[model samples]
Target: MARKIGLYGILAYVVYGLFFYWYLFYFADSSLQFEYEGSKADPATFLNGRELMLTEEYSKIRNLLFFLSTPFEWLFYLFILLLGFGNAFKKWAENSSKFKFVRTAIYLFWLSLFAFIATTPLNYISYSLSKSYNISTQSFSSWMKDELIDFWINFGMMIIIVAVLYWLINKSRKRWWLYAWLLSVPFTLFMMFLQPVVIDPLYNDFYPLKNKELETKILNLADKAGIPAEHVFEVNMAEKTNALNAYVNGIGSNSRIVLWDTTLNRLSDDQILFIMAHEMAHYVEKHIYFGIAGYLLLSLVGLYLTAKLMEYVIGKWGNALRIPAVNDIRSLPLFLMILSMLLFISSPLSNFVSRYQESRADHYAIEMTQNTEAAIGTFQELTRAGLSQVNPPLLVKIFRYGHPTMLERISMLEDYEINNKAKTNE
Candidate 1:
């Protein structure tokens, strides 16, 4: 019964992909319109309040990928397949007359290496495409350099993480998933510590926010929020990619607000402060801890059930294909691709977790700063720079959006301000 259900799970993935592709092409709009001063009755119509538009159509399409949804869906799907199949294939290779564990290991190593290389080109392509349109400062070479840096850094990290995960699973015969997640807390902590100060610097230059007055205001806001210190920083994210993003990353000394230079260049000081305050809400509320905790719990369940069936699936089908080792380097792409598919299917749940936290932070930021106009302007600037989809489909937003759209956020702010005025008038 478990095997049958597992097979169905895999099959459901394919069917879902076909459905989403159809939906994306047929129904998803290329442009989004937002009202800054008013709202449309339709939930599908996102309102801000201004008469101005926040995004161009192409940007809408692009943002529909990346931050909202992956543009390279196939690539993501194939990655998962390789990871799932490789380990199970190992046991089969063990039993095979011609296959050996060394061969399997070699296969996996190459598969991972090649898979990383192939997907890497798209990293450059995204930047190049933007530059060609005269929207980006990045040259192909510059983007490639950043891509190579990220590739090496993430590739090395992957090997270590994979080794740790496999070890926990391999050593513990039963309930390995539980053990793996239990240990992942420290691993997550290490990542939080290292990401801003270490991993990020390789790809983008991190510097102190240049505007002293703005920085001081942010620091005061942080102090008001009960954070110990303030180290406002800016990064040259536009030098690599044009995506406008801001995040509250790190813990303690490593803690800081990382704003993309594009974000700084586009938003006003007040708007920037609002954005910073919103990011602080995440740290103040400890959203990252909750996020990691949730992921670990999910990973425990997903990896355990999936890993168990992997052996049977590979033995029955993978070996029959005459592929001696499913874990071969060539197969690495496929494995990762498959895992991404499962994750994609699981996206709605993941996105819900992210959206809830982001929304909470948005509300917190509004409360902390009490600057609805700044918040509205910040949302508008981000929408214009990032080319956000104003009102995405319910399912898509629930599944894809890591943060609420400019239209959604600004509308919430607009309503609050309007209500506050009405109360005062009363």
Candidate 2:
């Protein structure tokens, strides 16, 4: 009976995850659905559905997510570290392995601590994990610089957010969530504006575009598309590593064509032209607007759920804190844990949406470039530069990868080209 109950509990978790999303995807009216064409008549139109949804949804998600996510995310991190330690110990004991449980525990303890203090994870994770590969550009000092900057910024931001939210919730207990939500909107907007503007700069150097010839070529493309040429710029990506990349970020004044230094260094002039054309495709599609909209929709729903759920959860932790306020710092761990669970449950769905968008972008990139050979070459170089696993396990890739593996993308591109050629020959 006990074993049966355990199995049912496991089954229930899986069912809850699936049912929650089925309700969202099936019942939800996110007509924000999109289709990508190789050569769109108006590139900006690709993101029409998404753009329509952005402002409406953005308001709901940003506030709700920040509040819900703030309390639970950190706790999830602790859970993972503990689980990893426990697993490592179990393995060590089974074989009496070279590294005993005690030693293993010590190693994980120190590495996680150093990783925490040095902040060399996330964006530079490739550097830490790619030690065996030829592609990583992270040195200890460089890693430390990334780690420290990230730690202070996040740590300081959390301290302020928690303090302020606690203060507000104390004063407005009956309907404090509404005011908190409103206050959070400006904070979210500030993050959207300042994150890429201020926070991004602290990590990677940004500069105005140079190389008049290359700039001119990009400018002409923008002009042809009716996108202002002055909006495009270059950032110094070469200082850290030789990995080529580019993307379009923001809308209006924030919107700009950002080219990584490595991209300029690696690709031929024509290749760069093709790459920029692909990026222009995204700008033309208005993807950012819709993307933000999707985020808002997800948040509003999540926030409603969180406020009710958090009150119940926080009430328990509140009794323990002797502080009736919902923003007790001691309960931070519990909230973070809940958020982590929420994210874990949502991970598969998030990846599904991301994968769909990425596929559309890839299709647009190829169509705008109209250069299959160049596209292939660019992807190949990127795969090598980033040391991408071309054939990652399907389950692994599905959960973790936002973009299709290089092999899958290359295969699709090749098929498209072959089909087009057959028609041409006919």
Candidate 3:
């Protein structure tokens, strides 16, 4: 078992290295090495009513708060380490032996509640900071309602997953990881399909964009990109957030290009078109399907590593932790801890792939729109409005940033402009 674990670890490491090299060297824009001319002398000159100082301060503080919150988030694992989760799970298991499914559901409820309570303070603090910074517009009560809804949704999902996972573990202790990984693929896809329709509407109202003219413009861009323009939808997000954002989500019948009302209100038609083009590029380039494939691949590797690590930990410390076997519900915390740690360590690789995909979308956006000015302005406005860090530290970028730094994105646009001009001259 140890030999197999070591062999799997080595193979995973080598695969990750190759993937890293490919994404960094081939997939990503190597031209990210351009000179940034720095922020415009007058932020208002680029966009009306923009203040650089205030925006920069907001960006810095928002980023700092997020960075500091990481360790606080990790405290849940610490609670688990101290046998808090194990004891709760054991107690729940003892009390609800009448029905296996009901017992699992109760265990899940307790576990989810434990995590929610453990993390709520930090979550509230983050929310408060966002509100203070004018990023959040939702009132406290509304926000709490959303949080509770989210908790229950997650709890509902976890109960079924826990039941399935433990069943697999009991049936085939040695091959449970393989079965679990396979199960995750369909479950993830189903959730993705449901999220845009069933889940998202729980929090906010989505409508066919109210701006008919802008909708026409975006649909035209979508048509140019050879994607279904009818899939474009707008979320009534201004009631909850002042942040400007848009994204393409889901796959097949569930797929949609969603723009925030805040985004439509704040950005110009050209800028909105640029953003729509970026989102369209995700589908036009088949990134939605490709992303799911990448996720499944990583899950396969992660689950295998998790199973190996969980076995070793149980063998060594089961007596002390009171964890009898992998199938035992009380051992969930330890299993989760190992999986979380592995995923954390592997995040750089994941982030690299994500950054590469985003860069491709950026490239497609530029090509599809042929409006470098709008692309540049969109980033500048988003940086100011979203309080996004234009330049983050190297380690932070590798581990945390799913997209390139705002500065890196701006630099890529500049590179695109220069190349486009040279091509025109030729």
Strongest candidate by TM-score: 3
Best-performing candidate as measured by lDDT: 3
Q: How do the predictions measure up, each by TM-score?
A: 0.77, 0.67, 0.86
- Per-candidate Cα RMSD to the true structure, in Å, reads 6.0, 13.8, 7.4
Tens-digit lDDT string for candidate 2 (1-426) = 324433554565456545534443344332221332232211232334443243224322322232333223343334433334334433444455453334333333433444364333343443544433433465768767876776677656765655565566567755655665666666766677666577788888777777888888888878876777584567876766656788877555666688998888888777787778777766677766666666665555554555566678546534432323344333333344455566656767778887777777778767766788787777766655664444444444555677776656766777778888998999
Candidate 1 C-alpha lDDT tens digits along 152-199: 776666666555555564576456557766777788788889988888
RMSD in angstroms between candidate 2 and the native structure over all alpha carbons:
13.8
lDDT of 3 at 289: 83
Point out the higher-scoring one by TM-score: 2 or 3. 3
Whichever of 1 and 3 has more TM-score, that candidate is 3
Instruction: Tell how far residue 182 is off in model 1, in angstroms.
Output: 3.4
Q: Which candidate, 1 or 3, has the higher lDDT?
A: 3
Q: Over 4 Å off in model 2, which ranges?
A: 1-126, 171-179, 314-325
lDDT of 3 by residue, 12-119 (tens): 555655554444334543122333433431244454444555555565555455544544444455456454566767677769788888888887777778888887
Residues forming the 10-long window of minimal summed lDDT in candidate 1 = 40-49
lDDT measured at residue 219 in model 3 versus the true structure, 0 to 100: 83
Candidate ranking (TM-score, best to worst)? 3, 1, 2
